[model samples]
Target chain A: MAESRHLGDIILKIDHISLSFGGIKALVDISFQVRRGEFLAIIGPNGAGKSSMLNVINGVYHPQTGTVTYKGETRHHMPPHRAAELGIGRTFQNIALFKGMTVLDNIKTGRSLKIKPNFLMNAIWFGPARREELEHRRKVEEIIDFLRLEDIRRTPVGMLPYGLQKRVELGRALAAEPDLLLLDEPMAGMNIEEKQAMCRFALDVNDEFGTTVVLIEHDMGVVMDISDRVVVLDYGRKIADGTPDEVRQNPEVIKAYLGVGH
Target chain B: MIYRETGQYKSNYGADEQIFPIRQDRIGVMIILALAYLVVPFIGNDYWFSAILIPFLVLSLAAIGLNLLTGYAGQLSLGSAGFMAVGAFAAYNFMLRIEGMPFLLGFILAGLSAAAVGIVFGLPSLRVKGFYLAAATLASQFFIEWVLTKFPWFTNYSASGVITAQKMVLFGYAFDTPVSRYVLTLVIVTLLALVAKNLVRTRTGRDWMAIRDMDVAAEVIGIPMLKTKLLAFAISSFYLGVAGALWAYCYLGTVEPQAFELTRSFQLLFIIIIGGMGTIVGAFFGAAFIVFFPIFLNLFTSTVFAGQLDPGMLSHLEQFVFGSLIIFFLIVEPLGLARLWQLGKQKLRLWPFPH
Candidate 1:
């Protein structure tokens, strides 16, 4: 499953990315590469532009200066849906499960980019639409099985505890069957046990689906444990990028981030 | 014991995704259908059909349409009755101007015309949200009524501004009697409601609910908000439009712009709020509550007062009671009567084992 070794080409490359809001810069000359089939963690203090970087990668924000190259091809002004259809899936910094929907329905919506059910067929729900629905439902159910969400498949996500809500958000991202999964603060606000579960699932997703994961997290335990490499951000600039041990020992990183025990 | 489905299990996704997944629910629906189709036409009196059942069925359909947009999609729409007016007039115009145009085609075309108008009004939703979108839709309600009234040709220039719908013929049979009209209304509502039920459980329905929950997240996840929101508006309007046509042609047998006034719009809004937002069955419960509450109040006040109280005072009392009840339901069970129905079903599922 390539768990021990990340021996693949660079899959996503961001070059000289610079973004500013009015007079303030959110990201300045932040450059990094995400290797194929690897877990990459971005860690920083508050206002570190970690989320903004992920947003840029997903086409939610167009950086003032940058070229996002994926799979050796430079990106264009593709809409978010087109980017999602191109196999880029992400969960929100805060849990974004549809409040009124059941866990199963929320995950099924993750398959929206891939489904081909036309308006009329969806309205009637017979023949091809039914077949497509079953096919997608089967996929979603398998994800439900994978994430251990079988018990609460029919429960509205808003009613669930915070930990379960984050799990459902992860399940939705996984439902897209994406090549690159971006998780923003997936383990935030979770207890140790829930944090452990989320890390295990993140690793399992990389191992089983061979999905390359890029995550923004404040939990150094998780970032250092599962991440193959770490990128540290402070004040919209990348201070250090290396293996966890290397970044942990770097003098500048220690002074800037680890000095405050972040 | 009849409520239980302990031994039976769904074998596949298709079977599992069945609208009434529980075997007991399937049977319950069948029993209700059997009663509606066979019993009502024969046993129900004319007063029951004309005064109670026809309006109930039509308004229920209208409620479902509004629920689709407002409840399921989280798009506030106050122009539902206006869309209904569009449908009624569109059908009337189609019937009047065309030679030998079938009533069925007229109905479909009317719904389509409403859908068109609905999309036009829904365009503002791309730029606005929440209460602003609602205000835009509210404008449609007044705008449509104004156009229908000012242009007397919509009513065929009748002095009284009423255009009586000719015999509602289906397969050459005239649906003129109260019983026949009730049957037609019932059949149409049932079929549309069934289609809506099927819709909400599927991908398209999920998209609408997705936008309703969080539009930004929905867009980031690849749901095209513009497409989804407008489609919600279009489909919701189509349902309301069809209901409007039924109200005029089947219930009133006439087209009058006043029939679908702004008050009618508010009535539809109240239907979804009290019925349970985002539920197909909630539409019926809400409509029933809205339609029957006034009648119940009138009867109760009349019997209690025994004609001693002034009718105006009694009417005011009825309004106060109705307003208070709406507030009570909203505060207590904000999900509405549909939520209550669900709770009842859940309780029934575990009956004989109290805990």
Candidate 2:
């Protein structure tokens, strides 16, 4: 699996992050770094705190003990919306598309952060708002083309198949043109063919756009095939962190998988 | 075949983003506008102008206002009448107090004033949702009405909290006759509806629909929930306020608390329900049904009875028929008459093909 690893300077670093709900601990003293333009996968059994790691990275879940550094600035608590503004986009573990909206509109919402039209301008739909809207529409159309979603462009997300809905969610995140994309179980409910398509798109997104992607999933095959690096957690603690080969051979990840299957 | 739009192709985003992109739709709207501006006022008499057309136009405005909030934003509100009352009284006061205040400007300020009140009432929606939010809005509606009734300054101490609406004179021309008023109402409603139709396609409008479909996901996508929700409230009230001004000045010729009561609030809520929620054309359908169906029923009943039935009993019969029709519509086409209209258009788009 040796290829041109597009790893550059470390763009995002999480240091000793710990999150908890009341007496329940979600993550315990976890640390990881994602290099620029590389696919990083977080994998573990159920309740291994893999999803929590993604949440903490994007500030959706505040850690009880940790700091997140992006680019150069280290902030103790950057709000999730602020992360979005800083070019960090994300998808939920469960698909969360606007059920009533068409596929194109879902993707267009991604460009909303970049387009800054005042309320008055938006109400009138002229001047700055019109221009900005046209500009964002072009960007969204590009994403729709890349994702091969031209057929379902006008279909409501609710009526689409589960697999296509996931693609639309990915298209939405890509529409943001984010520097860092966070994906949570994107291929969770997909079949073998669907999983292969998703894995291909994920790679294409990273390669074509040079977007830094951090994905959390239980599918070791997809992880090994697509990820440049892998992080293994067990019982809310980071057990192993290394290249795909290194993580696959790690005794701890094997032991943890054998002990509890999820 | 005559209304076919198969050859039209949009080449740019500007063309694609138009409210009516299909060639047939654009031509249809243009023709409708021409009729409204050039033909209706010439033929319509007094009853047709005031009792039917004017109220229908104003109710459509109010229905659009509620649709933006309750339909698009997914925030239930029962205080629409209260907001309308605030608009009526506020506009009345602006005309009474402001020196040389232009009629249109006075109405605009009144709309802003209603928006301010709407924002206050909408604050509770931040914490509560669903049924609780409706209760909060109902409270605002009642509270605003009570305040307007209790304070003499609002009505200028007129008998029974009633203030006669001032003449709407813009650009040195007084719109006094039913024809002039009808034209004025038609122009105002058309302009506002056009603006509203465009607004829902914009970024802010998408934010509202996002909130409606799913609020948590909306927030995760960087949509500021507070700002978007409040803007929905403000803009919705602005439309309602303008409608209120029109309802008073152009239609009723007086501002009275009795006209904008709880029943009127429910009537507006019904308009969105029976017309179709979330579509601009739905508001007009809902308003027309609410306004004309009863009048038609009364005329039929009198003709059948040969003018023998008592007037009170005839009124009750009209009420019974109206109530049953609303129930039938809600049961048979919960999506509303507008959805029916849309289905018809879709059929026409593929007329030769059965599909």
Candidate 3:
């Protein structure tokens, strides 16, 4: 296969996005641009609207204030399915693998957006549908190989250990073949070894696929290491947005991480 | 060792995706089916055919329907009996209203009618889940039974709200005899169950399981929740509807509205729970347990404990034992007897090695 081209030329621009839950504001006038193929990290403390930002990008929770423009197209309150169709894939902050399903099946669920054949063809188990299924299965097998989950691919996700389950979740999201991937706390519950393995996989995904990634993480070290740019969120507002070195030295981000100066 | 899969390797997708991936399982199923079709007809007695086999087969089909909704889809329903009632009544109506309608067609049409009603009740599932959704299905149970009983039209204005079956002939073969009725029910149930098994392997089935696991994630992944869930209800009700027709036409030879009450739904639910939720074979296990346990208890009470206990006490004891068994099964192994069987097989596969 030809080397995939860099996605950095594309831009995901969030323009003055504001989302409110009932009467309270969850995100207020937040705006940021994520260049394609860039590993962007959103860092914030508890209740800093980090998850809400990811949710807005994936069309989970639509913003009330401003439109989101992706690839120069203005998108206002599109459904999650449309977002998925538009090449946006995301993993939940809390692991959300289909527990009763095998790791393979859960990954196959990610391919749902791409499959076009109707139920009749599927029910009869022949023709175009069966061929499509086999094609997808090959792709899923490749993913399983990439993730080194060959042994556990047939095991139900619920039975897997938490760290492996997290990997399976990533595998599922990757199955969508999205242009932009949103990962919410990929290293949340992992130990040092698992975290390193995850960081390596995440980097490989970006390098190999040239896919743009936006991650929400609390680990500043991991963020500084992998992220091309870091966005700091505080109280539903953008506090700082710059290169890792620039954001680390910024007084506002320092104060947000550690309490204000004595 | 006959069940071992050693030396069998799947080299392609077709081999890997076969319904019975293990060659032994495939052979075993074929052998059992051969026995059922070829041998059982000649050797099986009349009493076994009429009292045990026929009712068991019908109830098993009903259990399979309930399992699809409650077990696989995680949609708790208390309206199995109501859907079955719709099938029986609809079949009856089709027979009475349409001139020269075949019995088989009437049963199929009855199932379709029940599916229509099941979809209507399934609408509430979109807004609710768990116990609340279960309560909503109760509305279906009550409403269907009430309508069937109160409305004179359903029973053809029969004096007692009872619908009796006329002699049902399929291609001039009368299903009046126990053997013929058993064969008909067996054929229909086996075919439908096979369809149900295949249905669960399709995208629709996966979509339902995804919804059961997490609706939000399923929807986010682009599964149309409404379509998948409603299809489950429709298909499940269709099965129950067919089973209902069989119960009335083949088993009872007549049916009343009271035949499909809330208690019947509860019985079906219990069967799925104790048999193993989500496994097709579990439906049969559950049905057999539910259908035979009472009869076994009655016989044991009348014969073995005849001198030791009074008849009234034995009846009460039977109820207590049944209730206790359900509670015991739920508490000890919520996965039910199916899991136990699986565990036994696993141990056999790995004999002499500690798991």
Top candidate, metric DockQ: 1
Model 2, B1-355: lDDT tens digits are 6667777887899998898888888999999999989989889999899889999999999999999998889899999988888888889899999888999998898889999989988999899999999998999888887888888888998877889999889888999998899998898899889888878998888889998997766776788888889999998999999899889998999767878899999999999999999988999999999998888897899899756888898888889988998999889889999889988888887887776
- Between candidates 2 and 3, the one scoring higher on TM-score is 2
Q: Which ranges of candidate 2 are over 4 A from the true structure? A: A1-3, A260-262, B305-313
| Model 2 chain A lowest lDDT segment of ten | A1-10
Which ten contiguous residues of candidate 3 chain A have the minimum total lDDT? A1-10
Per-model TM-score, in order, reads 0.97, 0.97, 0.95
- Summing lDDT over every window of 10 consecutive residues in candidate 1 chain B, give the lowest-scoring window: B1-10
Residues A188-248 of candidate 2 have per-residue lDDT tens digits of 9899999999999998989888999999988888999889889998989999999899988
Q: What is the interface RMSD of each candidate, in Å?
A: 1.0, 1.1, 1.4
The CAPRI-style docking tier of model 1 reads medium
Quantify all predictions' global Cα lDDT against the true fold. Answer: 0.90, 0.89, 0.88
Regions more than 4 Å wrong, model 3 = A1-7, B352-355
| Backbone Cα, N, C clashes tallied per candidate | 0, 0, 0
Per-model B-chain TM-score: 0.96, 0.97, 0.96
The residue-by-residue lDDT of candidate 3 on B200-317, one tens digit each, is 7766677778889988888778788788899889989999999999989989988999999999999899889899998888999888888898888888778988879877899999
